[model samples]
Target chain A: MTADRSSGPALAVVGATGAVGSVLLPILSQRADVWGDIRLIASARSAGRVLAVRGEEAEVLALTEDAFEGFGPGDVVIFLTPPEISAQWAPVVTTRGAVAVDQSAAFREDPEVPLVVPEVNAHAVRIRPRGIVAGPDCVTAAMIAAVGALHAEYALADLGVSSYQAASAAGRAGSEALRRQLSLVAGTDLGEKPGDVRRAVGEDTGPFAGPLALNVLPWSGELREGGWSSHELAVRAETRRILELPDLPVAVTCVQVPVLAGHSLTVRARFENRVDAAHAREILEGAPGVVLVDDPAAGEFPTPADAAGTDPAWVGRVRASLDDDHALEFFVCADNLRKGAALNATQISELIAGESA
Target chain B: MTADRSSGPALAVVGATGAVGSVLLPILSQRADVWGDIRLIASARSAGRVLAVRGEEAEVLALTEDAFEGFGPGDVVIFLTPPEISAQWAPVVTTRGAVAVDQSAAFREDPEVPLVVPEVNAHAVRIRPRGIVAGPDCVTAAMIAAVGALHAEYALADLGVSSYQAASAAGRAGSEALRRQLSLVAGTDLGEKPGDVRRAVGEDTGPFAGPLALNVLPWSGELREGGWSSHELAVRAETRRILELPDLPVAVTCVQVPVLAGHSLTVRARFENRVDAAHAREILEGAPGVVLVDDPAAGEFPTPADAAGTDPAWVGRVRASLDDDHALEFFVCADNLRKGAALNATQISELIAGESA
Candidate 1:
């Protein structure tokens, strides 16, 4: 049943030494069915590092235009670097007939690129005219994948999102660094100064900009001019794009909770098309990569603590939202590393194998 | 400073065996200068129990007519039982010629019963129509205490609220049970049937009614015919009441995060009056019990971790909500056990002391 390895697309991974790439290496290396000759690429600091790819040591190569010189045409390349780095070099890879599956923000909004979540909208992967497959932001990907499953049964008109995101989305440094500030906040010697929350503000100055250990922080990222944070704006735009709601009215407040991994969202979606709770449940039950963990009667739900290492976006708390006939409320959780980033990037690569290579 | 102890009002606390009672017990007893004489009452289960009150071991008495023998007219009572129990016994406590500070759903909607959060509407406590100072729901007290402080600076037209609550709000049994289920969900072995969130649905059923340890349950209670959960409806109604916005439209989603204490809210208040981020920060700085933790340059914010054992509602993320002109978004975290319930109930008693008993 083994296919000829020479006929498959050669896979190249960018940013192999970084946060998500550390997990990506294991997943990509183990996924030999879709990858031909795998290449591990990182920066100068990690140039000589070796990763276990398909149980063999794959030497990490520095990311450069010259690095792709020996690779054949129509190869599949996965980029986990920053948007600027991926944007600057993605074109070079694509120009040489490589299908670029990006985990960065580079090609997501580009009209020519198709930001695809294979579980939600796999059909979009087929129309990547620029040889680039963009992965949605982790929160956006986790949400759209869950709600999209519900949309199959009903049409959503208004979207209200409240995100409980972990510090991890800011990357390994931000989340890990938060561990200190959070512990500090939690361990604050309130000692009967009436231990007000504002005092924690006076105690903390680094990493999280505030304390994060045991508290819930509603403010995340810098406040944009219009009051939205970078995270909030990304959610609104990315959701609109993925749901194909060009001018959809979406309201979102993205908060940074004290969780260590995964992102959880409290969403109330109103659809123009009416579908009762039972029908909606049936749709989610049949949806791909959607784990319906919503048995509220017993207090079952989908939280980051539960979704940390899981591949699917764990969705629950599904029921009606408001008094409106069209609205539905649900909670969604996904391991930002897996479904939000690495797993999605890997899923897009399968499409790259089907398309360019 | 030593006033005649018998000169003040004789106070009684019903449902003193509950979580809120557990916290209020020490606050009321140890700090009785704000009060006169204190009596601890509970259900038959806790009747014989001896709890430390006012630095003395007070005998817990069952809530019977005989308990009201010495405490005659012009005394005070605080009911901390469930609504079903409170509704049945509130009138009884009030009829005993005492001001009843009730912490139940009993009289929240009753026009005669003043829903009170001492910070926002402590003056409202002065006019207990039916001799009952209604302690608001924990959700309302925490939000209104914070938002009411903000409301003084600006007139809000509408509000968007998202609550990150703990299981303790459901009761001590509910909280302890959610903890047990979470342990099971995390430690349980979900074998080949992994992708399905319910690898073993009935394997671990605790007080949460489902697996709640690592999950976010969106429906805090049963979804009524109209769709909103009991928690959601109560939050919305309580917000409207506490803010004195009978017509103020609030779209709310109550999501239960797996945190043990503190209820955090991500709120977007759309004001009728013009307000800016800087002005809001400036206003909140001087607002009672509010501490400005907004410093985006350093990634600082107020979190539940920081708000854990604090007495005040911690507010941060004071910015706008998307493109709405009237909208301002913020994060609020306060110790659910303290500010959300017990501390609030204790604060209400302070108002009782201000009166001639």
Candidate 2:
């Protein structure tokens, strides 16, 4: 899918009023000017609402087939909507001769649609035969930049990851639910007894499986076979696909923590070759889209509080496994709304824009 | 190390005013009366305070050699003080002929002293050649009961763990810091930008390496060799010692979360034989110190909120690894104060009391 280069390619953003979209607008205004016209599109309920983009007020367009009438090959439409909406509208926009960069799971596993993280697999974006490119899940997007950097040096063979996912990964409702629950439990001695937090959080769990205030929920997305969550399986599948390791042994446990934004992960990677912490540090320090915050002696490890609005994956706590010299362990944090969602999609859109130019 | 059973063994409690000590007193009073007289002991600063144990107020005695003069061979003194205090006073209490059960890291690595998780290694308490017993760290204590039961069935060969440790793992001050930091950031939009939370929680991290309010600190305990935290190394060491798998390949990452009291762990265990989720559930259900809460279809997995004031290790989210049939993945939660500290120590004291009887 090529865009006409008469002028810079136009960009259409669906779900522009959402959590990720709200973060995307300010980012679009701040980054290099690569778009001719930026269109803000949303559901009927949100249509006509004025949103600021590129320092100008733009009215949100309702989601209809007419919304893509004038879009052409050089234009790009980004979908930050839920999977169902993206699945329904991405093809409509693509059929109108524009490229669709989707941040939904609808077509991520589709072999024809490339799952692109520009830093790790920019080349994958060039071969999107379906005219749609899928963005990786927030959890995968948050860590792949750093993990890809390490894989280039160590030839990763096995992966074990435990996530400390923030509430924002579930979108606006998740974040509001956590804030409301925290407000209900704050200044009270609530967490010391069984079901106290649950009772305090009655029926306001938002989109989560249980109360997320003063708690960590081990489940994310719907339950799958063998008791795995859809989000957990998505992480395993997407990571293998992006890393191009078809048979990598991947085990993941996804957990939802109480943070309002920024997702953190504890990663254990075993490579085919022997690896050490110092060399891993050197690799991460030089990798693009990765920021090394190591130097624990100086209290400089990464945490969600520091990584919440950052663009790069903040990596630290790098160590060689005491039992296996082939294994390295590290901790990583990234703003789930930025690098994990909007930033990666914007980066992919830029890659497509350059191609059309 | 046997206690005298003239009537019932007298129990001496040290660090009576601290976090774990405060929890231990109530537990000792609620459980069966295994002690003839309960003696409260603390530092000179807290010597005059009165605390209730066994439903009676008792005057606290200052820690001095004279305090142990009346303690004899049938007495038990439980030390919940800091490592240095336990290292100093444990031998003194033992010299006076009372069995010392220490909940400090000072003697955990001592070959002469046994690390006892009463449910997993009750027999080890029988041969305390140094007349002192050590309790495992909170992380290890939180999950060992379930892991031990699974090990008995499949024979654990390798282990990997990532902990979602609560603030209380650092003691009362840790909990206070989180509550204070929460109050500072509560009802305010603080976590979205870089350093906003740290700025809001300026210089009051209290026993943590960073701001733990709305954040997950990956560094716990002092930074050790190769970027591993002391708490992380302790989990690996203590798990091996208690499981008696000295050469077991173990990797651990201890992270401090925003939760208050319960410590949760995601564990990956590879065993000698093939393990399945159903069979693992059966074993955990029958395990003495484990409570099975599997059944994710009904929102029935373990969380710190539900396990905070609980006695047993709440085990759930059990699944056999899709890649490695011999490996099983699961989540476990336990109250860091109860089973992780006080309850285990009290259980060991009761074992001694039964010996005298």
Candidate 3:
């Protein structure tokens, strides 16, 4: 599902008033090469707001170590903050040469960074030794983009996720504490016999210590002691280093529902040989950012309002787990703010502007 | 989770105004025991409404075929409709001899149907052959009440689930289509753009043909032209006829979350021997209606908002899934409106009233 590239780079969106940097500024202003000039930059409490570019508005500014001072090296910089503001503005905008493209977890498992997913391992961004470039965790980029399009067709072993995840990936204040605990269980006062005043308001919340509306918070990020949670070891070490399966065997379980932006998952995977569930639903009905809404009689698959705000990765319940004939069991839905975080940093800034065009 | 009951039978909820007969008439009038006179029935558009007993209010009669007329010959019914209204009210309430209990999926994979689960097959309901005593698809009775209390101290085989399910097990109009598609994505219009006005207001509802508010649907029921989905072969013939593993292989994936009740699962299981995930978390921390709530270094697992409206079955992300020493992974939530449907039909009507006391 490609094509739509109106033109090339010269960007910068850096935390431009948050939330997947305001959805990677109009999906890079709806890819209308609509000619260069982006530079939005934010914080200092979103410097003088105003956004909507190429049609008007624009002016946001602020952010500094001198908003990059001379700055102009911007030919792509993305990083929607936190990992301590992307470990300090990704080496001050890739040491001023630019091409940062992050989405924090502060440069995924570092080893000289390069997590890119311009369609899975966009040639592991020509081995980036820290002009940084990481970006995973949106349930490891929608389960390695449906396991790198099912490792390009049947060949994945040991993966068993269980993510539901949402509350805007714990942002926008955990989606306003799941819209004030589902507006206090839809104004529950169950005492007169509706639910016994919501079961005696048992377990309260303050941006989730529990009770996020109709609840579901299987402890997602930050819990590292041994109960594993840094969003389940960064989705089991980035789906085993982006499916190059360095000894695969991944079993993630990053919960956090009360969704407000879609992230649903329930994968099962497990193969090498007998993959049947009708050839794992014909290799996820011809893979690529998946869409196969499996039909089990007729409760059709894939939903998050059919993958809220498109950018595909919205599969459906594809079965075959009655015990495991090479286990398969699916269900996905993306849009964790567009293909999990500003469309993988604007498709890795279009493969870093197609390798510096 | 027993005692908590008193008196006994005179009960007959029979899908009494649905949704697990309105959480089984306030747990059969506050923690069960209906030993005489209590009927409820449904459908004449939920008859005369009103539901509650110990705390007053009862009237809701409609389901006929001579609505088990003035019961006297063995009064305990239960039924919860479907499988074509329990195959036309289980042989008309077990042929006038009233003993039903059926939760519909017809006679759950009938082998002369026993399918009970009063704590793992109440002596296969003393050989039910026709009195039609069935019940177990509330995710196979909260997953064999957590694998038959961890197969009563470790040793089981081949299993794998992937549910997340909710939307009130598709009833009470699929819990009002997940609370009116989560009030149509919390009352739509989330523009500053991200699924701008819900793909131009697409996703209207009806147990979902569209719109499930802040979404995630992945087929709940229907679909099975040999590609599984009567909620994945009722979790594989009710967990192989209640862990009597008739060729045990059970692979499920019945997801559908908007979180209006609980159901979460993410299992892996696999055994035959090996078993180590800290001795299957000390045999699921000493089983029984199971609880463990795993630790995963401390994000402390199990969720559906901590087993919403709890009644146990809560385990949590245990581990050892990856280098499978007999595989494990974890998580299993519960409360699909009380232990997946009115407290397992009020604990199989207190084990058919302590087996004829």
TM of each candidate vs. truth: 0.82, 0.98, 0.38
- Model 2: per-residue Cα lDDT over B88-120, one tens digit each: 999898987889999989999988899999889
- What is candidate 2's fraction of native contacts? 0.85
Q: TM-score of each model's B chain?
A: 0.90, 0.97, 0.36
Clashes of each: 21, 4, 36
Candidate number that wins on TM-score, 2 or 3: 2
Superposed on all Cα atoms, the candidates' RMSDs to the truth, in angstroms, are 5.2, 2.0, 19.0
| lDDT, candidate 3, at A173 | 79
Deviation (Å) of B137 in candidate 2: 0.4
Interface RMSD of every predicted model, in angstroms: 5.9, 0.8, 14.4
lDDT of 3 at B293: 70
Cα deviation of A323, candidate 1, in Å:
3.7
Model 1 chain A weakest 10-residue run by lDDT: A186-195
Tens-digit lDDT track of model 2 for A98-146: 9999999999999999999998999999998889999999999988998
